[model samples]
Target: MIKKLFIIIACILLLSSCSNRVDKGKLNKVGMLVPETINDQVWGTKGYKGLLNIQNDFDVDVYYKEGIENASAIEHAVSEFKQKNVNLIFGHGFEYADTFNKIAKKYPTIHFVSFNGDATQKNTTSLRFEGHAMGFFGGMTAAHMSTTKKIGIIATHSWQPEIKGFVEGAKYEDPNITVLLKYTDNWDDGQKAVGLLDKLLDEEVDVVYPAGDGFNVPVIEKIKEKGLYAIGYVSDQSDLGKNTVLTSTIQQASKLYDIVAKKYAEGTLQSGNLSFDFQDGVIEMGKFSPRVDEKFQRKMKRFVKKYKETGDLPK
Candidate 1:
């Protein structure tokens, strides 16, 4: 009777251990929350593409909610995902960082990922793009192509490091170049960005960098109408106008998503705010327009190659 009791106890313990173990292969369900419509053809679209990449690579059940900006909306989306037993959740912008951290505590087994913000919880991570170098390169391109020696940047906010990099890069190319800066204070305000562009044009700014993804395409169109040069942001905009848009600073969002999913599947993804730069192939310069001279293009190529090899930008 004692031997029979011991066997029953050992078998129960073995079953409990098996149940507690996480099957890494079964980490298939993924959820994503975006701040705006995926039809924006820039940031929002890129985010959706990232989710698609994860789905294609991992063969996971992926779900997404658009216009999930507010905390209440976020909570609702997360709750729904929880019901589906989502193993991973992606918050596509920095705005989701704080809310995700708070929500993570409730869903301890689920990992949360966001972009460009601080992550505090063990189950959360913020992927920050080191875009300063690319911004610098964009500034250099603007400076090289600007006939007026006066360039302008219309950005969503003043806190973006790319703004500082743009200034420094333009000055690096031409010390006497004038860089005018304006802020829209909101990302999706195209009319406001155009109004700012007009203000810069009035100041005789011939080159413009519309740094917000929400308004870049329209701003580039305006720049084309004015026959002025522009530096595209987030994605390649050379297709907007071959002569008008000089080059673009690209963030390879799809690739980043694949990498993140792979790491998570391997159980090697670390928590915290992680940073990626040009070396990681996450940040890159898009195709240059025919407007950029060959001599300058070669120089730009050399700069990029050196930067990638040494992780140093031109001083």
Candidate 2:
């Protein structure tokens, strides 16, 4: 009778242990929330592509919702994902940070990820791109290529570190280079950005960096019309115009998603804010325009190789 009791106890313990163990392989359901439509051909499109990559690589059921900008909308979306038993959720932008933090407490088993924001909870992670180095390179290209020695950067906000990097890089290339900096206070104001670009042109600025994804394409188009040079942002804009666009500061969002998914599958994805850069293959310079002289292109290649090796940009 005691032997039978012992057997029953062992069976109960085994069942309990089985219930407590999380099969990392069963991390099969993933969800993403984006602030706008995924067809924007820049940031949104990159994020959606990342999601698709995750779906393909992990064979997971992936879900995404567009236009989830507000906390209320985020809550609703997260709740829907929760109902569907999502194991991981991506917020896709910095705006989702606080909302994800608050909601994460309610869904402790679910992990949340976002971009360019603070992560205070154990279940949340923020992925910040080290864009400053790429921005610095863009500035160097502008300074090298500018005919008038005057360049400009039209950015979406003042808090961007890339703005400082651009200025520093331009000055490093040529101490006398003039950098006209202006802000749009938001990301999507193409009209205002174009107006600012005109103002820079008035200053005889021969090169411009329109850093807002929403407005950069149109601003680059305008720059092309004026026969001026431009530094592309977010994606490779050489396809837009080989002669007009010098090069692009690229963020490999899809590759990042693949990395994160792999880490999660390996049970190594930790919660907290994480930064990725050239070393991580997350940040890189896109193809240089043929308009960029071969000498300068060779110089850029050397600099990129050194940076990747030493985590140092051109001094």
Candidate 3:
């Protein structure tokens, strides 16, 4: 009995150690790094919006350097922020993961946050988006909304887990529903995206989901031009076209930033990998277009309910 009691105590202590939330005292200045201009209305812009909100609510001095791409530029930005003695560094996007991992080790005094990041370091926190749920929703929605019973996903890269989840979701909605996957080797090549959309449209894919940052703009334009339905990705782009967008799967970056900032203030912020999903109130589907009727909304609501309860895509 005494040995069992000791084992229980040890287990409790181990759990506590694993979640060692250190109080860094009061935070002063915060720094932000984005690969693209904050005004790009997508990934970079979303992070910038979070910084703005952090500044407004927390009353902390916030400095950001946008349009800084490549590893050297990121390294330079980190050095500059370190010199400024910033309390926290927010590196927006997975691209900053490696750089943050390197810099966080060198600057152990400062806390590092990577939004949609993949670093797993002692001083760095990686906040990743669980996009599988989003993808499932996209597929289910497309399957329900598609007139041709065919949907297409135009992404910057080929299939990942999220894309697979999307395909699974569509198949779950309708086993017979056809999902076409296409990729644009270049994220900045809107024309390539448009070209891919043309092919999908030709193949009778009436519902199109564009899954790139700004590359989706022209793809959405093409969908509108063809009078086809569109599903936006990464950001809410309902207002981008002539109301052809059925809905958008969005990452609520501001809410993420707010959570981290509040946690930091509460001295409960731990350095590790954190993920946000639909269950976490981070990944969300934007307002549906008029094209999506009330019945479709009800179906989506039911699916969401089931997914939330099971943490699995509705079978």
Candidate 4:
């Protein structure tokens, strides 16, 4: 019975393709639904870039919808994509996994994919970045670059395995390093991020970073105002705030999008979990500002190797 079910699922997966204009071989349209603004230059931006990568590299046409937050909104978005006959529907965040999975099931002929999402379902695939290890290196970089030996992470959400991995990364950077972690309850509340970073500054923490998307910019500005340090995530952000940024541990999620979308076009779309890490250089550490110094970079290089070797940060 199990063998039969596997065969059935495999058969469905093989038939994953559906033409947009008609049920033909080539796909002329791809739809991207985003939870945040694409110009966020952070989370949503990475996704938009990925979609563009696929669009530019292939013969398929692309359509995008952004700023989807509510549960109902996500469902509506997926339904809309299905109606338009998008060959591939890309959801940029894990937040959309549940809805995407459901909609994909309803439209198995339509290809669906998510970035940084863990859930798996028939006709649906999710990909996640190995930010835990990269976050560890980010934390280590924070440790080496900080003048106070005390750092802060202004998260936009309470916490989860994913965020915990970031915290664990910080801890392993130094058993003695004190990490002041706090949440701003939402990602777009840049003022709140600034306030949280301000409080950390009162405690005399010279370096602070925000792990939440779109929240990093404000705190980075605040860090500059207080003559402190900050880091970026999701994209190469060293150029975003010249001297204040220590570095950014960026996830090139868009790059992955390019690969998956193309494979999908070539009749080679595989249904499974896909991951990228620092060792693969998919997760890149951004260039540090001059303040980071030669010693800090050297220390980070050694720690990076230690991380690739052991699958964890140097303790």
Q: Note the Cα lDDT for every prediction shown.
A: 0.90, 0.90, 0.81, 0.74
lDDT of 1 by residue, 3-23 (tens): 999999999998876665444
TM-score of 1: 0.91
Query: Could you tell me every candidate's TM-score relative to the true structure?
Result: 0.91, 0.91, 0.87, 0.82
Model 4 CA deviation exceeding 4 Å by range: 1-28, 158-173, 266-268, 305-312
lDDT of 2 by residue, 54-166 (tens): 77666678999999999999999999999999989999898999988888889987889998899999989999888788889999999999989999999998878788889
10 residues in a row with least lDDT, candidate 4: 17-26
lDDT (10s digit) by residue, model 3, range 181-294: 999876678888888988998899999888888698878987888888888888888888636888888888877887788777676788888877887788888888887888
Strongest candidate by lDDT = 1
Give the C-alpha lDDT of model 4: 0.74
Candidate ordering by lDDT (highest first): 1, 2, 3, 4
What is the C-alpha local distance difference test score of candidate 1?
Answer: 0.90
Task: State residue 184's C-alpha deviation in candidate 2, in Å.
Answer: 0.7
Measured with C-alpha atoms, the lDDT of residue 161 in candidate 4 is 33
List RMSD in Å for every model shown.
10.0, 9.7, 11.3, 11.0
Worst 10-residue lDDT window for candidate 1 reads 17-26
> lDDT, candidate 4, residue 224?
79
